[model samples]
Each structure stands twice: as structure tokens, then as C-alpha cells.
Target: MLQLIEEIVYQVTGKNGLTYDTDFVQDLALNSFDVMNIIGKFEDHFDTTIPTRDVWHLHQVKDVIDYLAGRGFTQP
Candidate 1:
């Protein structure tokens, strides 16, 4: 699951050195457009739809993992 998150973040940010603690907006400087793009990719990868409002709640990689877990996406 961690690797999955890493891959997704890397794909979106084009930064392969991301850590779970890395802040999407601060560390990666991911703007609103980037966030939207990331959410879209994550939806496709997880095969689930994430609400736009809820996307703001995700600040770090762990937040994404928890959100996906709530949607029953167990680590592979």
C-alpha cells in the first residue's frame, strides 16, 4: 500500500523521492490544478470516486491511504 501511494504521488508530482510525511501543497508545491489531476488519477487507480470537497482533507500520503482504506481499498 505504501508503495502504491508512492507510485501515485510520484506520477502526479513527477517526484520519485516522496515520503509519507511529505506535504502535497508545501513540500511538493502542488497547486489546486495538480490536486485535481492527482485525484483523478487516484480515482482511476483505485477504481473509486473521491469527492472534491474531501480532497482538501488530504494533506499527506497517509491521509490518502486512510481515505482509500475507508473505501475498502486494502493494501495489496
Candidate 2:
């Protein structure tokens, strides 16, 4: 899931070399619109709409996996 998020970040920022440590807003220069688009893709990919309150809590790749797991998306 982290890898998939990396891919989506790459696609969104048009940055081919994005890594897990890459900061979404700093390293990637992602704005609010880009964030929304990425979140949309994530919802579509996981078939779950993440709650808005949890959106601001995402700060890294692992956060996404944790959020999905918290939502019961536990596919290994």
C-alpha cells in the first residue's frame, strides 16, 4: 500500500523519483488540489472514502497504511 501511495504521489507531482521519505508538500510541491486528487485515487483504489477528519493526520507513507488498516482494509 505504501508503494502504491508512492506511485500515486509520483503520478500527481509528475516526479518520477519520489520515495517514502519524500514530503508531500515540500519535496513534491503538492497543493490542496493535488492532495484531493490523490485522496480520490486512494478511495477508488481501496474502495473506501477516507473520513475528512483523518485526512490532515497523514504525514507519511506508513500513515496511509495505518489509516486503511484502521478502516479494516487488511489485505496482505
Candidate 3:
């Protein structure tokens, strides 16, 4: 999942080396639009629409992994 997330993030930012604790805004220096774009990619990839309320809570890479894991996505 992390690998896949990294791929998606790279697609947008043309950047990599993200850690689990990386903050979307602080570490990636992304604005809300970029964040939302990444989220949208995740949703499309998983075929799941994360609730907007829940989406905002996912600020870190680990947070996204946790949220998807809770929905049955595997870590490895």
C-alpha cells in the first residue's frame, strides 16, 4: 500500500523518499488541492470514496495507511 501510495504521490509531486510519518503539507509542501488530488487518486485506485470528514483527518502517510488498513487494505 505504501508503495502504491508513493507511486501516486510521485505522479503528482515528481518527488519521493516519503516516510510513514511524512506530513502531506509540511513534508511534501503540498497545498489543499494537491492533497485532495492525491486522495482522489487513492480513492480511484481502491474504488472507495473516503468520507470527506474522514479525509481531512489523514494528514500523514501513516494516517492514510491506517485508514485504508481499517477498511481491509493490507500493509504488505
Identify the candidate with maximal TM-score: 3
Residues 3-76 of candidate 2 have per-residue lDDT tens digits of 67777777776765655566667676778888888898888877878877788777666677777888887663
For model 1, which pairs clash?
none
Model 3 lDDT per residue over 1-76, tens place: 7788899999987879988999988888888788888888888888878787898888899998988989997744
Candidate with the larger lDDT of 1 and 2:
1
Provide the lowest-lDDT 10-residue window in model 1: 13-22
RMSD to the true structure for each prediction, in A, is: 1.4, 2.1, 1.5
Full candidate order by lDDT, most accurate first: 3, 1, 2
Off by over 4 Å in 3: none
Cα error of candidate 1 at position 74, Å: 1.7
Off by over 4 Å in 1: none
| lDDT for each candidate structure | 0.81, 0.74, 0.85
Predicted structure 3, TM vs. truth: 0.89
User: TM-score, each model?
Assistant: 0.86, 0.77, 0.89
* Ten contiguous residues minimizing lDDT sum, candidate 3: 67-76
Better of 2 and 3 by lDDT: 3
